[model samples]
Target chain A: MPKKADNSGSAGSEETLLDAAGVKRAMDHLCREIAGALPGDCPVAIIGLRSRGDELAARLIERLAEGGRGDLLHGTLDITLYRDDVSKRMIQPQVRATVIDFDLDDACVVLVDDVLHTGRTIRAAMDALMDYGRPAAVRLAVLVDRGGREMPICPDFVGKTLKLSPSDSRRVYLDLAETDGADRVYLK
Target chain B: MADKTTTTAVRRRSGRSSGFVWGRKHLLGLEDLEPAELLHVLDTAAGFKSVSTRSIKKVPALRGKVVVNLFFEDSTRTRTSFTLSAQRLSADVIDFTGKSSSVNKGETLVDTARNIEAMGVDIMVLRHAAAGAPHLLARKVGCSVVNAGDGAHEHPTQGLLDLFTIREIKKKVEGLTVAIVGDIAHSRVARSNIFALRKLGARIILVGPRTLVPDQMRQLGAEISHDLDAVLPACDVVNMLRIQFERLQSAAFPSVEEYSRLFGLHAERLRLARPDLLVLHPGPINRGLELDSAVADGPHSGILRQVTNGLAVRMAVLYLVHQAALAVNGK
Candidate 1:
């Protein structure tokens, strides 16, 4: 659960936006929304961006299996080499393994991620995915959509819409039990 | 040299969680790199290894960046590896050999490199007959410089590919006894391997004849051995550096027959080695002289994998140097 986050060293600098129970509810709703919107007869691939997005994809796959849709092709994409800001950054980004084993031909691939902010990541993810194979259609699913999109892109499904202003100094972070110690969303 | 001071990066690991960032605009040699820097390149190479497996087999990491292969000497393998690596990373590559370039018309090496850099080249992969040509060019040019190979000094990517192959197969580099057999006195590959492997915590045994294997190599933290048979039993990995006859001015050993009998790794000598000994050769193999065709093609051989890993390692090096150059320019 989001247990009174105080790790930011101030009394009210960090707040637990969503608890564990709330995260579970949002995930269930997201799965239902995605299942209802997905085409019935087409092959679907659940692809995740690496670091946090891939873990969120795995959880999505598990939830889809629970709902009896267990036949989705899944993979993880590492877009380190596709970033536009690589030369602008001081440190070289560590490249992770991209493990898309299945063919992407004529399949509807859903790109999943934890947070959607600047939209450049989705653009990079799309570029990386296309290099693998030509999918019939590509959709996007994000858990949190704090809208500050620099690119003209939109997510097909979103778990939470915090609507945080793009220019605001505050930030939102997702802590999954797989990577972090708990399942919660915190605002800092 | 002014280039030495400008390009010599501080050899300390960064305190970042994922590890230190590569800060050098040029990859001159591995001799000055810290252990963490070596592992960082290896780890980055591990990530790039998958790009070759994909159907597309390309990444846009170096898109819009230009890499010029500036060679003052003749080479087939290293030049092609760098060329393909730059292509695979989506960088535009220009190949310049000494015969076709203006250097044959008495243009100085620095002038040639500076003229190329003026043509929008972002990085220069240099191979020269002089010992420190890349360092000299790095001092003269504004673009990043990568030493492909320099006279008896170092071939850093070859060293990195060997380290990558060993780590991929043996799963670790520390505590392994690596016997680098043949031509330690003149092999740039051997020198680079010793510098890189020593930094990565591997015990090195430089194996060759007493004439070819210099006692001065021991100062580099390697055990000097004249007998390959004795070194084979304890070595977990054996890298057969090509006997560089072109680099030899006088008779280093008596004859090819005597040298092969004493140091050549064949089935007969392979039997004396550990059953799981990993074999490596940095290409242009001297078929029967350095290793038998069977041993070079045998199950214990990682020679082909070394070539494959060479592409990834070169990609990592190019990507890193380009990133450093951009950072240095505040781009």
Candidate 2:
């Protein structure tokens, strides 16, 4: 079946990309997909891939709580040290803290990132997460799936799927009302 | 004449980048170091280790340079060692205790570092309660930053001295089993030791309370154990970390008595270790909690050697950093 168009309504017309109702619907669908993949009520965790992913994870938690699963462990991951390209980069990278509140042993983890592109960021996130604790299983989730995967990686739950030309780019601008106030994304 | 020849010789000796040419920047963590660079630091430290034994005990390597010791956390051993090391290298030292500084009067860390930088300080040795504080300050200030100890993050120089002490005793770091015992979670020393020891080819075993030894340690290639006895006999070097009572306010362990019974390295347990096993502690050792005094003062203990080597290691760091800065500036 073809994926549905994001008639989630026009994004720019709403003053911000995602409105409260649109965010709730997207989160609800995401939680359902995540719930279906996870084993029966085993203490699952949501490890957001820093910055925006962290905010998305918090929203997912709230959505899960409203749906009667309030026990999901939440954490944020910083993958600066684990990035393979750190040494080659000219600018000094910014490093944020990795905060995992619960032990990862035997826990199912939903690794969330804002977008899925080259898959390198997710790969770095995985490496960083391993430095904390070993999880039983880790499933990937993303708000937007803009295809350009250099590696074999697929998000289990995706909010929107957009195909872009090799030279062009698709950016997700999340605002404070929904995600965070930071207007960050890719350029062509 | 003789003085001109001596000056040329001194210039050649100082100018030639031996194994000691680290980058012209602050060393906040070993994570930023390459294997060659790490080895360079150690080899240079070995040279300084010899210089520490001389009667005059001073070098002009860092002459006319200014180093500031800005300690936000109270420490006698780390501060004093750095101060003496800077002075021995002929660098002017400015010592600032956090309690007496404007930090007590609500001055921010960056402001304090900037103030010190404005004084024409070339290096700032900082110890703070926040992890990555030195790294933050190092980016803002013009001077090079040397982390004394940041909150459960890293004490790079301590780690360097520990490695130096181990290499001195064991001859080589490869194929040795090293057990770091006690408060692993709250120890910047443990964090740095893990990096340095692992890089130099020592297998690490982290023995502590379940709360103190995070489950994630295994990912760092360390074997984690709650039972000290299980790891003692196999270790070639037993590094006892200080038990921080301050962190205990969070109830990381059940009780001090219980901790002593479970984790403390008494003389009996020390005997259980390999006969050639060396004991090490980043001191201010707790008498009965993490270690027994008898075992600490025992023949196998290298506690005092760590202190002595600390000065030499720091001297080597100052010397190398100064040289690297000079090289970068084309001086």
Candidate 3:
């Protein structure tokens, strides 16, 4: 099956990229792509990069279960101590737990996130993951791929490639079912 | 020197609002911190302790940040611990001692700090001979300042690390009878510990010679004790402070011989204390002076654990302050 075009509806300056239903569809599609792309089923893992990334990974796991591939393990990488820009950032980031119960050795890993921006977060997540063990292969899976590349990295599996103006507030507001009472994605 | 328009940005709470907000810009002393703020640092430290147990010990929370360890005095343990903490957080660290820096070439502390900050330094880990040196630099520089050890005033991180180590072993700080033994007058660690223990609802006994353990410290809320054996049986944890004989030249005690005979913590003295009593020391121990050689290496000694916990504690301090500064001046 070929990769379909990004189904982002045309909104000039700033718009809602994905609502609750849109997010579920994009997530279901991405999970299928990830399940197919990853080789072997024994040592497969899905890692979400803290906060909303973990939520996305949970949904991805649910989708994988529905597709009859439920053995894939999942974890979260809290890159509070691993960030490269601590001195330059405006706020002191918290060090969340990097909860990987399964081994990373020779595993086919899919690193998940809600939105992809400067690629620094993924970069940090990669550095942290390698510290655990050498994975056989690592893939980047993101729901929203906002193309403003600061580092030479891109998502291996992207849900929607939404381009925005330079001045478009590059913030993705996501509410998870785990914390907030609803599931939604907003770009403001 | 006062030409730079530096704003006095006190350390605020970091983002994500964990158990509590660590609201203090410069970690100069534990005396100024609320019990809740002190607990926040220790709790934050608890989170980082797991990182060291991992196969990969580095964290990227401070990747792009720069931490400069500015030491005016010579120290190996505190300096190395601070360096490792910064490195573990994935932050760029620069070790700047007074001997190597332009301060020897007549450059003032404020000037030296401004010069470093000019080069995009974010946090300053300072250890100075003069008291309140970090406080002076904190006001002058925009970067977050952490006093690794400032004269005889306070080694705040050391105090917090001690608390963490004690809690790790005893599981509580409240209602514990902690006797701090050794040079109370010239020891910053003693002052820091005294204040921290008082805040966490622990009963502290200041144990040393009358010259070292003055009654004035009683104002700090610690019980002034001249006799160690008298307070030994009632104590839960005994923190033996390092004897800074080099820093004190007035012959506070009659001799090294007399000091050891009077207050030296040996196996015999340890027997007088509670069976489950914990012994602690902030390193560079004088073998037979402050403590017996047996007790220094004894099972009750939390000395080694204190050293190990210092790394995580320092990491937590560096991370919390770095994050707090960022919350104030968003990236």
Report iRMS (Å) of candidate 3: 10.5
Summarize candidate 1's per-residue lDDT along B241-301 as a digit string, tens digits: 8898888899998899988999999999899888999999998999999999999999999
The sequence of per-residue lDDT tens digits that candidate 3 reaches over residues B1-331 is 1111111111111123353555566788899899888888887787788787788787766777899999999999999999998998889999999898899999999999999999999899999989989999999999999998888999999999999999989999999999998889888999999899999999999988999988898999989888999999999998888788679978888898888877889998887988899999998898988888899898898998998889889988987886777667654
Q: B322, model 3: CA deviation in Å? A: 3.2
Output the number of the DockQ-best candidate.
1
lDDT winner: 1
| TM-score of the A-chain for all models | 0.89, 0.78, 0.86
Model 3 segments more than 4 A misplaced: A1-49, A52-76, A82-91, A99-103, A110-123, A139-188, B1-16, B19-23, B100-107, B115-120, B327-331
lDDT digits (tens) for residues B1-331 of candidate 2: 1223332332232222231335656778876677677777777676565446544465555667899999998899999999999998778999999999999889999998898789788888999999999989977987788888999889999999998899989999989999998888888899899988888788999999888899988887888999988888899998998888876659887888998888898988776888898999999998878889898888899999999999988987776665555545544
Predicted structure 2, TM vs. truth: 0.60
DockQ scores for all predicted structures:
0.33, 0.01, 0.23
Task: Point out where model 2 deviates above 4 Å.
Answer: A1-188, B1-20
True-vs-predicted CA distance for residue B91, candidate 1, Å: 1.4
Candidates 1 and 2 compared by TM-score, better number: 1
Top candidate when judged by TM-score against the true structure:
1
> Which ten residues in a row are the worst by lDDT in model 3 chain A?
A1-10
